[model samples]
Target: MTRSTWRTRIGFILAAVGSAVGIGNIWRFPWLTAENGGAAFLTVYLLLVVGVGVPGLIGEFVIGRRSNRNPVGAFDELAGRWFRPLGAVALLASTVILSFYSVVGGWILRYTAASTTGAYFTAPQEYFAAIDYGLGAVGFHVLFLAMTVAIVYLGVERGIEVSTTVMVPGIVLLFGALAVWASTLPGAGGGYDFYLSLDVAYLRENLFSVLPAAAGQALFTLSVGAGTMLTYSSYLGEDRSLAADGTLIAVLNTAIGVLAGLVIFPLLFSLGVSPGQGGPGALFVSLAGAFAELPYSRLVGVVFFGVVLLAALSSAISILEVLVAYLVDEHGLSRERATLGTGGLFLVTGSIAALSPAVFALLADTLANVVLTAGLLGFLLFDGWVLGRLAREEYARGAGPIARLFELPWYYAIAVVLPVFLAFTLVTGVGGILGIGISTRGAAAVAVLGVGGAILALRRHGVPG
Candidate 1:
């Protein structure tokens, strides 16, 4: 019997991009910018997306195609037993990610139904506030989880690939229409100015303030740190170039993210709905208000929510696939058993997030950022320290000349510098969680020492790729 492979390069690209360009782009990005410094925030975000995000994405691909297994199996195959914990960490991170991911997907599903029923037309803010925090959200989350489980149980090629093929087109079409409509809204020009207009002085003054947020956005937007990409890449057969494919996937995902902002901000500006008061609820509260008041908005509301639902499902499918692949390949479980087992556990985890808004807030906010950064650091250490020469060889398998040259410098940065930065962010993040402002300089030193310690250990007794 033959092993399963991605149906086509186009399908793989679309599925991968679809996973990246989801709730974070539509539900998170605009608000993060507005919270920090608006246009200046946007400027910083673009820089990180290009400078760090793209290259990091390629690094994940290099791991995946080289190992051709789940994150746990991939690490176990590529490195010695001393590094098994890193693979476990990746699996744990993915599981943690999917928990909150499903909660947000529930929001999209609830909104989709609300759009049809005109639930928000009567009292947009109150409706959103009520449903977003309590039992209503829990129910919708279960619905979303069930849908995701159904697909994963169906197997990857037919379930994930096929649904993503349909969903991606719908997301594009709805966003295009929403952007067009936003331009005609009376006060939308202000939103565009607020979101798009550059503030060079502000950026220069608060560059440090925005760096972590921008970096977080870049990581989340590409879905890089969670091993979703690693899992996807593991199935590759090396028929195509990983570097080129990674670049294209990153570009398309970033483009859609920018487009989501274009559509969302303009509508908020036009409607006189401030994007901040609602926090994460801004997407729902603001859009609901617009639909309730604007001319012919009921029809538009249906289209917009439908679009969001499609995008949410595409991402949810990818999250489930990570675990589904693990169960079948690692444990020799049937696809059905894996899907049900993981999905049931997520229901409990996601319900905790839904019922306890504060927990949900932590999961969606600072805690999530910290976890992802740490997970990425783990992957980098595995690749650059534990798997250095071997990773370079895997990267070279189908890469071109320019990419080939980047192999060494990329190694130095990942092995040495990237981990330091990741550790510093983790400390700052822990500080934020605890409410402190101790010396960032000290944090930087700790980052360097931490990475150095790990590298020395790797050399002495850790896994060999």
Candidate 2:
């Protein structure tokens, strides 16, 4: 059987961008920005996106396009069965993320519908608290998962590429309009100042604390660590420059994130709602409350939450596709069967999350970051030591002269610098999750040791550094 591939380069790019631009940008980015030093956090985040995220993205693209297979099979085909476990980590990462992500998608779906009826306008916090976790949440999660499965079942070109082609542009247009309207809101200047103005002293004081959060968000927002990008790139039927495509995707994803902050902060400040308040409920509670106070509250709410729904669906589709692709490529399941089976699995897992607050928080806040970081760490190691020069060959296959010039630097960044950085973040992430305080020196030692062990293992596998 001939495998499905993207119909056009633009289709591939837009679909990839759709995966990248999601709740992470619309919901999490503003909250993280607010919790950190606003613009100071944004500055560091942009640097990391450029420095760490893009190179990591290209690495996934290389692995995917080179193998032209799903994550698990990509490893089996490229290296050997021993490395298949690395791919399984990615598969696990995708499963872990989507299991909880569907629940959040359900929340966005409910809000989108509720917005039209002004259901939550009267008391947004109370409304969210009521429906956040229960049978009601499970119903919405199933609805959202069904929508995602429908698309994935339709296959790649007919479903994902086509839908994102429309959805991505709609997201940009809606967000642009919302940002413009947010600018006109009374006292919006304060929001802009809060988001854009850097606090050098705050950054200096809390740089260590903020770094881990920002790094995790960078990985999450790019959709890099969970094999979504790898799965998406595996559909690429052409040899267009992975470097160029990766950079463009990163830039567009960052722009959408910044634009989300523009819309969210201004609205929050207009209502005098602190962005940091409500924690995970910040969007559903604070922002929903802000929408309630607007002149055309219902309409504003509908448009805002509708945009979120689209973003959520786009991302959910990508994650679901990871599992679906695994089944189809590795097990020879039909697309329909694979998607339905995957949906059934999430139906159970997502309902579990929707029903239990503790489980949802554990998956979303803690395990998601740790698993994604570890998954990306495995990918970079494979690309660096196992694939070695072949990774560069795939990277430079269709790259232009300008992109080709940075091949060596890009390789080194992904091979040496990123693994070390990811190791540090992984340690910090685990420590933060377990409430075990790790000193800077301790974390650094762990990172170095982890990287050394990976290198030694690869060498023993007869892979040249």
Candidate 3:
């Protein structure tokens, strides 16, 4: 059988953009920006996205294209069986993320349907609570999972590439229009001030407190850690610039996120809604209330929620594709069969998350962060150490002069700097998740140094890539 590959370079980029521009962009980015000093957080977040996120994204791309295999097979093929456990970390991240992610996708689907008939406009908070965890949520989760499964079952080039080609452009166009509409609302200037106004004092004083969250959000927005990028890149059949592609994905994702803030914050302020008080349900509740009072309430609600639905479905499709690719490559399962098996697994797991808020929080918030950080850490280490010299060779394969210029430096950063940075973030993030208070800076330093020492020793022993 012929191996599958992306039909065009644009297809791959769009699919990745679709993956990156999901719930994180639409929901979490705005919330984090508001809570962390608005424009100050955005500045730090953009810095991290470039300095760390893009390099890590390139590392995943190199691993995927070099091996042309799923994470487990890629690691085993490139590094040896002993290093395959690192790939397992990625697989684990994908599973944990999609379990709860599908649940949220279901919520978006529910909200989209509700907006058509103004179901939630009466009491948005109560509606969210009622549907947040129950059999109803489980049913919707299954529906969302079904949508994801159907897309993955269509084969890579036909299903994923084609769908994302349409979905990504639609997402950008719709959000752009929403941002313009939102800007015309009464008192929208206050929202702009809050969102774009940088408070240097807040950033200077709260740097440590804000860095980990920013780092985590940077990774999340780019869809780097859970093998989704790796899996997506594995389908490449041509030599395109990985660095160039990674940069574009990061830029577009960040732009849409900022645009989302433009739409969300302004609309909320226009409606006299306090964004900081909305919590996780802010998008649904406050926005729902705003829509209820607006002149073209029903039309606005439909368009707004429809954009989120597209965003959610596109991202869920990418996450589900990772496991399906694994089964197809590693287990020799047919694409349809593999998709069914993966979907079946998620049906049970997602239903659990849908029915139990505690389980959803555990997977989505605590475990997902730790696993994604670990997964990216492992991939970068392999890129820097195991693949070492060869990693650069692969990176330079389809490159222009500009991409070729940074080849060696990219190597060092991915190999040395990023692993250490991610190691620290992983430690602090896990500590936060587990409700433990440790000296975060000290522990992170010790942990990164320990790993660095081990890498140095391994190189001394003459390990081959």
Candidate with best TM-score:
2
The C-alpha RMSD in Å for every predicted model, in order, reads 2.0, 1.6, 2.0
Instruction: Write down the worst ten-residue block by lDDT for model 3.
Output: 456-465
Cα error of candidate 1 at position 403, Å: 3.4
1-465 per-residue lDDT for model 1 (tens digits): 144578888888888988988777888887787777778888888887776777788788878888887777777777755666766766676777778888888988888877777888878778877788688889999999999888877776898888888888788777877788778888888888888898888888766567777777888888888788988888787767787888898888888888888877877777667767768877887788878876677677877887787788788778778777777878888888888999989999999988988888777777667767777888888788777888778878888887778777777777776777777877767766788774768878877888888888886764565
Per-model TM-score on C-alpha atoms? 0.94, 0.96, 0.95
Q: How do the residues 189-214 of candidate 3 rate in per-residue lDDT, one tens digit apiece?
A: 98898888888998998876677778
Which residue pairs does candidate 3 place in steric collision? none
Candidate 3: TM-score?
Answer: 0.95
Candidate 2 per-residue lDDT, tens place, 29-68, comes to 8878888878888988988899889999999999999999
The model with the greater lDDT, 1 or 2, is 2
Off by over 4 Å in 3: 454-465
Global lDDT of each model?
0.80, 0.88, 0.84
